[model samples]
Target: MSDGRLPTRRRTVGWIVAVIVMLLLFAIGWVMVRGFGALSELQNVRHSVAQLHKAIDERAVDRADRIAPRIAQHTELAGDLTSDPIWRGFEFVPWLGQNFTAIREIAAIAGDAVDDAVTPIVALAADVDLTTLGLSGSRIDLVPLPKLADPLSGAASALAAADARARLIDLDGTLSLIADAVGETRSMIEDAASTVGALHGAATLLPGMLGSSEPRTYVIAVQNNAELRSHGGAAAAFIQVSAAGGTISVVRAASGLDVPALTEPLELDDAVLVLYGDGPWRIPRDMTSVPDFAAAGSLIAQRWQSQFGTAVDGVIAVDIDTMRHVLTATDAVQFDAFTATSDSITTVLTNDMPQAIPDPAAQDIAFSRAAQAVLGAALSSEEPSSLLAALSDAARDDRIRIWSAHEEEQDLLAASSLGGALPHDDDHDVHVGVLLNDRTGAPLDAYAAATITTAFGVCDGTPATQIRVTWTSAVPEEVAASAVAPEGGAPGDLRTLIAIYGPQGASARGGLTTTLDRRPVVQQDITIAPGESGTATATFTGAGSSDPLTRLHHTPMLEDPEILRADIDCG
Candidate 1:
C-alpha cells in the first residue's frame, strides 16, 4: 500500500513541475513579443520625431504637420506595449530587471514628451512663417513671435522634465546592447532639452529687444581677429542699427577707434577690476580685453552714448568668421577695395587688408566697410532664413557675444554660451578659462594661432589642475616689423595679455611671465618673437569635487584653438 501511494505522489509531482515549466515559457515568450513590438514602435517614434524636426527647421510646415501626428501615435503605442501586464511584471525580475525598467520608463517619457511638448510646438511652428522671422528685407514680423513664446516655453519645460526622467533610468546590470541604447536615448533627450530651452529663451527676449513695440538702438561691434582680446579681439568697427515696428536699418557706422576713451571709468566687477583694471573701461577698443562681454558691452554702450548721444539698448559683437557665415548666406554681398566672398573674407579681413592698407586707423575703416557690407547684404538677402541659420551657428561656436542693457533680457543672455561670462564654480562642470589679448595692438593674431591644454591632477578628491597655453607666432619677422611695428609694439615680437581663470574657488601658482594672482584668476603678460613660440602655465590646487567634469573655456581665436585634456600627477 505504501509503495502504491509513493508512486502516485511522484506522478502528481511530475505533472505539477511540467505545468509550471510550460507557464514560465509562455510568460517569457509573451514578454519577448511585447518587447519587440515596443521596440518597433519606439523606432517609428524616433524616425517621425527626427523628420518632424527637419521639416520644422527647413520650415516645411506641411511635411512637419504630417510627421507630427505619427510621432504621437507611435509614442503612445510604444508606451502601451511596454506597460502591458506581462512586460511590466518582467520589469521586476531581479537580475535582468534594470534593462526592462529602463525601456519602460523611456517609452513613458517619450510618450509624455510627445503629448506635452511636440504636439503643441509643431502646431505653433506651423502658425509662424519662419522666413518672415528671418529678417526679410531688413524687417521681421514680430507678431508671430509673441504668440510662439508661450507654447515654446511650455515645450521646453516638458522636454526638460523628460530629460531629467531619462537621466534617472538605471543602466547598471542591464545587457550591454540595452545599456548602449538607453544611454543614447538619454543623450538625445538631453540635447533636445538644451536646444529647445535656448530657443525658448530667444523667443522670450528677441521680440522686445528687436523693437516690436518701440524704437530701439543697437551697437554691433565687429571684433577683429587681427588683435585678439580676451573675449575675441578688439572691436575694430561699430555698426549702429535702429529698429522700430519690425523694420530695421543701419543708422551709422564708425571705427572702434572712432569712439574716444571714457573720461572716467565706469564701475567694474571687483574680479574684473582686479584682473584687467581700468584698461577695458577706458579704451573703447579694449572693451573685449576683459573677457566678460556684459561688462565690455556696457562700457561701449556708455562710450557710444557719451560720444554720439544715442543710448544703445544692446551690443552685439561679431568676428570675421561669423561675418563670413553671414556673407556666405547672403551670396550677392558686394565689397569695395577688396573682393571677399565667404571663402575669402577671413583672408580679406585679417591678412589681405592689413597688408594692403597698413595704417592701423585706416585699416579699421576698411574693416568697418566690410562689416557694413555684410550687414546690408544680410538685411536684404533673398534667403534671410539661411542668414539666420548662419548667425545661429556662429552663436553656437561662441563667436557672437551679446549684451542688453535691459536687465531681464540680459539675464537670459548671460545664461547662454554666447554671453561670454566667466562660469562660476557651482556650474555643471569644473571650469578653467584661458583668455588671450594681443598686446601687440596689431592684427598680429591673424597671423598666429593658439594651442591650449589642461592637465588634470588627482588629489584625494576632485584634483586641482593646470592649464597650459602655447601661442605660436607665424608672422615673418619682416612682416611683423612691417605690420605690428606700426601699432607701437616691439617689431617682430608678439605681446599678449593671457588671463587664466581656474576653477572658481581654487588658488593658483604659475610660471612663465605670470605674477602671483588673486585666487583662481592669474594674469600674465607674455611676448613671443615672430616665428617663435611662448608658453605659460597656471597650476591650481583644491579645485576638485566628488564628481568632477573639467571644462576649458577660451575666447574666440582667429583659428579655432585646439583644447586637450590629460590626466596626470596622481601622486
Candidate 2:
C-alpha cells in the first residue's frame, strides 16, 4: 500500500511540472507571434508610404488617395497589435520587446500623419497646378493660391505631429529596425512641411504683397559680387518694378550711377554711416559695408522714396548668378547688344561687359539691357517648371536675398533663408564670421578668394575657439592696374574692412597681417597688393558653448571660401 501511494504522488508531481513548462512555452510563443505580427504590419505601412510617395511623384491623385487610406488601415492594425496592454507590458522583457514598442510608436505617429496630412496633401496635389506658382507668365493666377492654404496647413500640422512623435522614439533600441526609414521620412516630411508652410503664407500674403488692391512699387537691387560686399557684391544696379491686381511689369531700370543725390538729410544707421562713408546716396553700394540686410533694405526704400518721390513696398536683391540661373532656365535671352545665355552670362556680365562696351558708363547700360531682356523673356516664357527650378537653385545658393518692408510679408520671409538676416544664436551654435567689405571701391574682388580655418581646444575647463581668415588676391597685375574703382578711390589698392564675428558670450580679440608685413597687430587697415594675400586671426574664450560644431556666416562671394576643420591638441 505504501509503494502504490508513493508512485501515485510521484506521477502527480511530474504532471504538474509538465503543465507549468508547457504554459511557459506557450507564453514565449505568444509574445514571439505578437512581435512578428507587429513587424509584418509595420512592413505593410511602409509599403503604403512608398506607394503614396510614388503616386504623388507621378501626380496620380486617385492612386495617392487610395494608398493614403490603406496607410491608416495598416497603421491601425499594427497599432492594435502592439498597443494591447499585455503586449505593451512586454516592453520590459529585455531584447524581445523593443521592436514592439518601436512599431507602436511609429504606428501612432503614422496614424496622426494619415489623419492630418495624407488626405489634405492629396487634395492639394489635385487642386493646385504647381507650375502656376512659378510666376512664369506676366500675370499671376491668384485663384489656386487661396485653394492651397487648407491642405498646406493640414500637411504642416501632420508633420509637426510626426516630428514630435519621432523625437520620442528610442533610436538606440526599437527604432533600429526602421532607423533609415524613420529618419528619411522625418527629414522629407519636415522639408515638405516647411516648403508648404512658406507657400501657404506666401499665397495668403502674395495678392496684397503684389498690390492686388492697388499699385505697389518695388526696387530690385542687382548685386554684383565681382567686388565682394557685405551683401553679395555691390548693388551695382537697380530696377524699379510695379505690380497691381496680380500683374507685374518692369517700370524702369537704372544704374546705381543715376540714383538722384539725397536731397533730404537722412537718418542712417551708425554702422552704415561709419563703415560706408557719406557717398552719393546710391542704394546699390550703400549696403556693401553692412551685414544686416533689413537695415540696408530700409535704407534702400528710404533712399528710393527720397530720390524718386515714391515709396517702395519692398526690396529684392538679386545677383549676377541669379540672372544666370534665369538665363539657364529660359535657355537664353537676346538683347540688341548680345545674347545672355547660361554658358556666357557670368563672364559676359562680369569680365567682358566693360571691354566689349568699351565705355565704363555704358557697361552699366549693357548689364541693365541684358538683365531686362532676360527678365522680359522669363515673364513671357512658357516653361514654368524650368524657370521655377532655376529660381529655386539660385535661392538655395544664397544668390537671391530679399526683404519686404511690409510687416506681414517680411515675417514670412524671416522664416526663409532668402530673408538675408543674420541667424540668432539662441541654440548656442559657435558663430564665427569672416566677412569682407570691399574698400577698393572696385570690382577687383572677382579675383579674390578666401580661406577660413578653425580649430577647437579647451581652456580652463571651457571650450576655446580659434579662427583664421586668409584673403588671397589672384588678380593679374595688368587686370589690377586696369580695374575700375569708384570715382574717388584708387584702383590698385585692394583695401578691405575685415569684420570678424565671434561666438556669443565669448570674449574675442584678434588682428590682421599680410605677406608684406610679417607682424600681426591688434588692428590695422587691411591692404593687399595685387597678386598678394593677407590673413586675420582671432581667439575666443568664455563662450561656454559645448557644441563642437561651428558655422561661418558671410555674404555670398564670387569665389567660395575654402573651409577647413582641424582638431586642437588639447594638451
Candidate 1 lDDT, tens digit per residue, 1-571?
3544557788899999999999999999987887778777777777787787789877888888888888889878878888877787898888988778888898899888888987777787776754335467788777667777788888899998897678667675788867776676667677677667766776788789878878999999999977888878888899999988778889999998898777778765566666667778788888988666788889889889989999899999888889888877877455667878889988888888888888888988898998998888888888876777687678767788889999988998897776777775544456677888777867878778888877765555555687778888888765766754534356767888787777655666543222223336677778877778888777777644222346677888768887776564434
Q: TM-score for candidate 1, please give it.
A: 0.79
> Residue 435 in model 1: shift from native, Å?
1.7
Q: What is candidate 2's lDDT per residue for 1-571, written digit by digit as tens?
A: 3544557788899999999999878866786787677667767776777787677656788888888888888777867777776667777778756655665677677667667877777777776655347365877866567767666766776676576556556545544555655555555445455555556665777788777778888898887777677778777678889988778899888876666556443555444444455541344465644566776787788877776888899888888888888887676777656766888887777776755665655766666677688788888778775776677668767777778888978886876677876655544334566657776766667778888777777656766776667888777766666776544445665777766666665665333322111111122247787778898666666653334556667668866799886664334
Q: Which stretches of candidate 2 lie over 4 Å from their true place?
A: 1-58, 63-119, 134-136, 154-194, 260-265, 273-283, 357-359, 428-432, 484-493, 510-525, 543-546, 568-571
RMSD of each: 5.7, 8.1
lDDT: which candidate is best?
1
- Per-model TM-score on C-alpha atoms: 0.79, 0.73
**lDDT of model 2, residue 235:** 72
Error of 2 at 431 (Å): 4.5
Best model number under TM-score: 1
